[model samples]
Structure formats: C-alpha cells, structure tokens
Target: MKEELLKTFGAQFETPLIEEISTVGKLAEVPAGETIMDIGNYVRAIPLLLSGAIKVLREDDEGDELLLYYLEQGETCSVTMTCCMGQTKSEIRAITETEVLLVMVPVQKMEEWMAKYKGWRNYIFESYHNRLNELLLTVDNIAFKNMDQRLVEYLKKKSEVTKDNCIRNTHQQIAYDLHTSRVVVSRLLKRLEKLKKLELHRNHIQILEL
Candidate 1:
C-alpha cells in the first residue's frame, strides 16, 4: 500500500505527507459499476485514486442522475472533501467507471493534513477548483449544447477517462448519466452513427469521429 501510494502521489505530495497517508489510509479496490458513495450517505472518508476512474454524479428529487465529472488516477473528489469537512451527508454519488484502486483517508485526517502539509492544502484547493470548473462545464453543456452534442462530449470524456475508444455502457446507462430517456439516447446514438461520429453495437459503442 505504501509503495502504491508513493507511486501514485509521491510527485505531488511531500515525503512526510506520503508517509502519513500510507500509515493511516486504507487501501481499497472496487469493481466497475459499483456505487462507492450515494446521496444522503454520510461521508466517512475521501478517496485518492491510484488507478482506474470514478464518476461522480448528482441526483434530483425524482431520482434522476446526471454525471458531474470523472476522477482519474491521482485525483480526489472535492465534493466529498466538502462533505467530510461539514460532517454532512453526501449530495452526490460516486461510482467506479472501471476496476479501481484507491486509498481512503479518514475524514479527520483531511483537516489535520490541511494544517500540517502545504502539499495537502494545495491539493485540496486544486481539487475544489477543478471540480467547480467541471460542474460549470456540465451546466454549460446542458443549457447551451444540443443533446447530440452533449452525448458526443460525454462519450469523448468517458473514452478519455477509461483510456479506451470503445465504450461498454449500454444506451440506458448512458441515458441515466445524461439525465435523459433511453429512447432519446437510442435515437441520438443512431443519428450519430449516420453522421459517422460513432458506431453503435449491441452492448458497446465504438468511437469514430468522436
């Protein structure tokens, strides 16, 4: 665990900070599609991604979900950090996008490290800034972009995060992430196919132009 932690975060974190994380953080491996955190759940820890990716999502009262952003290796969720600091329930859900390896740092350590480590403080602030930008981008896409354009951007993001041009999520799953109907997603996907942007398969999508 220490070696993995160092390999993932050593460049960004001070030696002492890395040592502290290795000593106190719990290593976890989660499979793809597993929900690591959910709305209304009290956050006990913040995750530091070591490998793979996790997608953070927001949910409405109607139970509809929209993907906020993806956290890849060496990234942490700022929203989760906020919840930990406030001792509040999570407003978003975090799910594994692929098999993931991460280190879970207890909530208390978050504050402790902020005061003790400059690297930790910088990391926390940077996480917040990056996440805010992503949230704004999501809003812009929904408000200004067409459904097809949003879908194409979403696929491009997914492909980038998973490091694969072939997307394995179903149309319905993509609909849930985009906060739209499966029928709508399917229709848009077919349109994209005809436009030579992507090729739709029975269970996966192969990116072409996107």
Candidate 2:
C-alpha cells in the first residue's frame, strides 16, 4: 500500500517523509455515503485521498446541517489537521460521496511529520488555506446570495466536481444540502427547467445551458 501513497504523490516529499508515511499510514477503502468523520467526535487520523471524493458538512446541535465543501483526489481534510494540532473534536463531518480510497496518517504521525518535514508542513498549510477559502465561500453564499442563485451555482459545482453534467441526486437531497425545503427546491428546479437551463428526470439532472 506504500506504493499507493507514492502513486498519489510521487516524489513530492523527501524519501524520509515518504518512508515515515509508508511505515505509519494505513490504507482504507470507504463506500459511498459512509460517514468518515462525525460532529463532536475526535478524529484520529488525517486522510489523504487517493481516489473518489468526500463531502464535508457542518452540523449544529439541533441536527441542522450545512454543506461545507468537498474533498476530491489528492486533497486532505483541513478539519483533520485542526484536530491533530490541538486537543479538539471534529466540528464538521465528512462522508464519502463516491467509493473512496485514502491513506490515513495517525494523528501523532501527522503532527510529527509537520515539524519534521518541509513537504509535509507545506501540504498541511495548503490544505488549511484551501479549506478556509471554501468555508468562506459557503458563508458568502448563505449570507448574500439568494436561494435560487445558490441552488443554480450548487448544481453547476456538483456537475463540475463529479465531472458529470447529469447529476444523480434527488430533490430532497438537494434541498438538504441547500438548507431549504424540498418544495422550494422542486420549484427552483422546475423554474430552471422551464428557462432551458437544465432538464430533470426522476433523480437525474442534465445540464443544458449551465
């Protein structure tokens, strides 16, 4: 499985760092829709995706949730980094959006590698910057954008992220992600369809102009 690590990021880190990862990292294959991390729970490892994607979400105490972002191939979850750096539980949750293959570095090794290796330090910093921007964008959408515009942009992003113009999701699923009612989502989708922006079937949405 060490080869899998190299395959994901070949020669990007020094040989010593690579060897450390090889020795300490564990490979995991997660099925689509499975929760990898949970709210208020401690995260023990920082995962580096080798393939597929993970959806990151933030949930409140009352069980209300918001779609935060998605981590795809070659990306690490910054929330994991935060858990590693301090004594803290996960504030957000991560669920596999598709069958996922990832290498998990134990929290100890994650902290050690950050201090011991330059490449690992850079990687952690980059992950932090990227995820921070994603969270900010989510906030901007919620605070400023209208639900219809947000829904359209969300669909466009979903299509781009999955690399499929035909999105395989139900109206209820979309509503849940957008923090809106299913009836509202259905109405917006119908409006988009009528405007020639997209076509919707039972569970598939085909982008025509978006």
In TM-score terms, which candidate is top?
Answer: 1
Residue 121 displacement in candidate 2 (angstroms):
0.6
**In order, what is each prediction's RMSD in angstroms?**
0.9, 1.4
Q: Mind giving the per-residue lDDT tens digits that candidate 1 earns over 18-107?
A: 888888989999999999999999999999999999999999989999999999999999999999989999999999999999999999
Give candidate 1 misplaced runs (Cα > 4 Å): none
As a TM-score, model 1 comes out at 0.97
**Every candidate's lDDT:** 0.93, 0.86
**Local accuracy of candidate 2 as per-residue lDDT tens digits, 32-151:** 899989988888888999998888988767787779999988899988788867969999889888889998888888767778988888888888999999989999999999999999
Tell me the deviation in Å of residue 61 in model 1: 0.9
TM for candidate 2 is 0.94
lDDT of 1: 0.93
- Residue 120 accuracy (lDDT) in model 2: 87
Q: Give the number of the best model, judged by lDDT.
A: 1
Runs with alpha carbons beyond 4 Å of true place in candidate 2: none
Clashing pairs in 2: none
Cα deviation of 147, candidate 2, in Å: 1.0
- Residue 86, model 1: lDDT of 92
